[model samples]
Target: MATPRLFVKGTVLGYKRTRTIQRPSSTLLQLEGVNVKEDTGFYLGKRVCYVYKVGRESRCIWGRITRAHGNSGVVRARFQHNLPPQSFGATVRVHLFPSSI
Candidate 1:
């Protein structure tokens, strides 16, 4: 059987950017059904994964939610490696493991 779904899907809106610069070290994500900042509290420190394909190989970059980005539910994440620019608009998997519950 296929692995059961146990994670939330998030969107890779883009990297954190300033007026004239972009910081790839951090990325901004909006989780499904999360519309308010308070809803993001539970996801903080949660694991995030960006999966992609290169040639015939599938690769994944792991990261963790660092903090809430704004009044909305977007959260900031720091990854082991900076995500590619192409990741913009891509889908990310937010694992609910390592739970504090």
Candidate 2:
């Protein structure tokens, strides 16, 4: 039997660095119930998706968790394209795939 995949819900907390930095930064995401640095490692390399609607059409930007950020259980994800400002405070999905199984 095939194993079921799990999708963890995360919130887009904005970019990786402070506003004054002025350089490009990876998107920051905080997973639900993940509030510690230790828990972030398990999610490294996991796939992330930001789904939104553009008029009648739905679109999604895919990314992967590249590394853990800070001690607050936040993660840094690099997407194929930079996410828009509207993505902040929005929800994203983290999928458990590319499994070791």
Candidate 3:
């Protein structure tokens, strides 16, 4: 038998860079239908992927949820490469990997 894989849908809000300094940045993701701060904990440390097409081929960028952002349920994610500005409002998949099972 095969094990089931889990994935949650989320949207990219933007980067975590501050004004006057943009050396380091983190992506912000908002899980679909998840609007409570407490619920964000469930996704911490989970794998996340943002897939986009460069042309006819699709490419994927992976990341992990670092922590919860604020009281509004947004979560912070650190990707191998910083997500582009065009990815804002784009959808991403949060994989339930690195499981404890």
Candidate 4:
């Protein structure tokens, strides 16, 4: 049974950060069912979007998956506009575009 979905679900763990610094331009994410480092390879260069509700309207923040974040299947996303702090722990949609699939 094939579905009509065109994207995958991703979680915004947080922004790329260090012990004393954080870079909002680089956001960290984890895609559903992608639990291995090698599995993340296919997602590289793909686009990602964070959707949020604003009163009765909706908004989105677009980004691209730069590379695998670590050995635990985490991925790093770079956006033109830095994701707001409120996006932390938010659900993002990973699109299989750029025809890389």
Candidate 5:
């Protein structure tokens, strides 16, 4: 038997540096579970962390108006790479670290 390494915990704070052409791309969410420089954490798959894109003034930026007042935004996180692609949007519990290897 082998022991599993535990990841850290926190909420998503931003979008992934790269994005899809038709939709908001996912990015690294800033973690609140530890110091600002710490890179390890985990998330409970059952809940969603609110995602709001903001500008220099910290005002929410509305990329598009799908409805009368709708904005295009996104939330993303880094998890074990072996997980399937469908797992991208699904609520997930993740163990994140500084490096993939």
Candidate 6:
């Protein structure tokens, strides 16, 4: 019951496989690979995405950080059966690594 934290890497700012309430869910998302370090409010580069709930309805990839509540940053990955095979708009090429210590 303790094995759900898969995020090979990061930087994939695009991907969506919608469908819920019934079934089908697969999420391989990213967007949080740009840090400059400030006061510690998380706004260095601005962009949050880390949803890794591979197909089977076990979703739990949420995100939130509104300065006051304007809205433009959100990664609501609510899966239930199938969502993660992107190619809708096309422009994918996300590669980020640095965790092999």
Top candidate (lDDT):
1
lDDT tens digits by residue: candidate 4, 9-40: 99999888899999888999989999999999
Model 2's alpha-carbon lDDT is: 0.89
Model 5 Cα lDDT, one tens digit per residue, 1-101: 88764543333343333365422243333334433332221232322223233465432211210111112122243332222333333332234333335
lDDT of 6 at 55: 81
How much RMSD separates candidate 6 from the native structure?
13.1
Determine which window of 10 residues in candidate 6 has minimal summed lDDT.
Answer: 90-99
Best-fitting candidate, measured by TM-score? 1
Clash number by candidate, in order = 0, 0, 0, 0, 9, 5
Model 2 lDDT per residue over 67-101, tens place:
99899999999998998888999999999877664
Which residue pairs clash within candidate 6?
A: 24-81, 24-82, 25-81, 25-82, 26-83
Question: Where in model 4 is the C-alpha error above 4 Å?
Answer: none
Per-candidate RMSD, Å: 2.2, 2.3, 2.6, 1.4, 15.7, 13.1
The model with the greater lDDT, 4 or 5, is 4
The whole-model lDDT of each prediction reads 0.95, 0.89, 0.88, 0.90, 0.31, 0.32
Q: What is the TM-score of each candidate against the true structure?
A: 0.93, 0.88, 0.85, 0.91, 0.25, 0.19
Tens digits of per-residue lDDT for model 3 on 10-100?
Answer: 9999887677655336888899877989988878899999999988999999999999988999999999988888999999999987676
Rank order (by TM-score, best first): 1, 4, 2, 3, 5, 6
Residue-wise C-alpha lDDT for candidate 6, range 1-101, written one tens digit per residue: 89743332333333333454332232233334433223223332233333444586543333322231113332223323333445222222222222232
Q: Could you tell me the lDDT of residue 38 within candidate 3?
A: 94
Greater TM-score among 2 and 4 belongs to 4
Candidate 4, residue 82: CA error in Å? 0.9
Ten-residue segment with the worst summed lDDT in candidate 3?
16-25
Residue 3 lDDT (model 3) = 68
Model 6, position 70, has a per-residue lDDT of 17
Candidate 5 global lDDT: 0.31
